[model samples]
Target: MFAIVRRHPANIAWIALNVALLIVVAGLLVAGSRVSVTGYYSEAAWNWMAGQSMYDTTGTGFLYLPHSAIAYIPFAVQAHPQGDVAWRIISLILFVLGCYRFFRLSPQKSEFFNLSAGFVALLLCADCMRNGQATVIMTATMLLAIDAIRRENWHLCTWLLMLGFAVKPLSIVLILLVGALYAPMRWRLGVGIIVLALVPFAFQSPDYVWQQYEEFGLCLFHSNRIGYEKWWAQLFGMLKAFGLEVPDSIQTASRLLCAVGTLAICFVLKQKLDSKRFLVWLYTLTAIYLMLFNPRTENCTYCVLGPALGLFYAEALCGRRWFAAGSMMALAVVILGSFELGQHITPQGVPPVWLAPLACCFFTLYAAFRLTSELNRLEPPPSREAQPVLE
Candidate 1:
């Protein structure tokens, strides 16, 4: 027994730590209905069976589209008469599993980071009001696609991306566009995956689906061209600093800029995407793009907090002491200005929605602020890649 213990010390230690964290998490969640989607998701779900509505479209001086309509599906799945307590509990559980899967899907088995990643996933369940699981589903799909493409398994990649696009249209652009940087051959597969995503759902209402395609343009124009003041205030402020409106043209341009920047990072900066570190950057870009450019990112939508927060917290596991100290200071500002920390999570910084994203950009040194610029300056990641696998 002594010899066995000596041989598997890290293994034993990690198991013990995971148990403690799991217990603490279960205790916190079960204490009460503290972290919930509130009534919003149920309402959206109920509205779906009620009228097949999309995204809080009830009291709208605005139009509703079925494109964002799937928010109601899980609620419909749970189908509690009260549509309140029992149903949300189920969605919350799914949200947890989704996060767990996302973290597990990461290439590294670093317990420090994996468990930290799991905690961040739990944070998604704890804070956000909108379909918290939606982002989970999206992350899962994107990660699966990344996995498939890395192995050059286009068949598997297509199926995974199809599920992602079916869940939410946002993945249609992010997964496909950003994916082309490393795996340009896979872009055609991406478009095919998107086309296939509609087949089964197409049977539901092909014309409505096509109409949603048309609405995509309107959605872009509405959010980009006609600005709404929400959490993205700082991000939009930066765009204004550039003397531009958030027009469809600018929306197109931003994506092009992100794409060009990504390519430049790969070619010019010589950043390589074939390493384990690639997903870190991929997810980072998707999250930041949402925060910076998405028309709205409410406090409830704090579900995306997992990837950024996970990367942020994992820095302590990194070998940077002073850098970690500075990150802690910056993280303090993020918590104070962004999250509600009353033992239960609430989104506090409505006026400063960009705070979380900006914090993510600042705090995650390995990816956003440092890498995009660094990668742009180098050759390509694979050639300069010092190790075959990046830690």
Candidate 2:
């Protein structure tokens, strides 16, 4: 086990690189996350500070929870010194903790490695630090749950999932889908989720909580698709161009098809996927999650594309993939999702007419192909050996 950890070039390189990225990009992300505390989260946060009822702030443009905002207590409309400091502190903690969980999820020998270098890797990936929000909390808690699963510590996994859900509902999907896919971790984690989820309601003012939930649901489905062009529109739009009349039905089916196809490819490949392959899978899944299940996502949501870039670079170094496509798209995201893009404010609605669904189609297909092969790489011991391990 120690030899394996020693063999991790990723960790050794990260020890040096991670600190630099955190000081640079992570710093930027933290600032970005806090910038427009204006939308729903801001409104609710400000209102809550005023000792008024806290209702759904989604319409105000806060898709995820105002984790730091909430903790700051009492509305952000009038800033207090302690409140501001508290917000920064929370963001820092979430950022560091998130880095820890992610590293632990990687190859590690001891719990100590899980605690230190794994976190360093996370900080190394620290792309979303400045504009951190509930997503920070979401990523941190949920990844911890995932790490716990890898450790076979269901008790801790449950607590992490609960912590994640309390920050953002969608985060629960990480715990649910991944845990279920890796089924053995189910029992304790699932129970922890249920209890943690329900326990919150007990203390939260019913009216306050219900109003927020109502707003979340309403804003969720009722929202317009006008933000950025739906990434899936490319394939569907191409089919439409041929007069095939692709509808939401086709959209749903396509996503399912992608999932099944990716899984099958992984199963068939049956090899340990290098990081680049993992990137392809991450991109494929993220693309589907955002385009199909996201219901409402915007340019800003592209922050996650960093992980894809990381994987792509890792793979490229291995002479596996060309850097052009990932590079260009990543540049596009950095340009669009960045603070600089806020000034443009062009009422560009969804169906991102400019996305050239053709581009999207090719990108999606390539990613799916990559991910499937990666999955096939993960090997399990034969049944006889597996039984003893399970026991």
Highest TM-score among the candidates is held by which one?
Answer: 1
**Candidate 2 wrong stretches, greater than 4 Å:** 1-35, 38-42, 49-51, 56-58, 62-132, 187-190, 224-288, 291-293, 318-366, 369-391
Best by lDDT: 1
Instruction: Write down the lDDT that model 1 would get.
Output: 0.49
Once superposed on the true structure, which residue ranges of model 1 sit more than 4 Å away at CA? 1-74, 81-108, 129-133, 182-197, 200-234, 237-256, 266-274, 300-302, 318-322, 325-350, 364-391
RMSD of candidates 1 onward, in order = 8.7, 9.3
Q: Give all TM-scores, in the order shown.
A: 0.63, 0.59
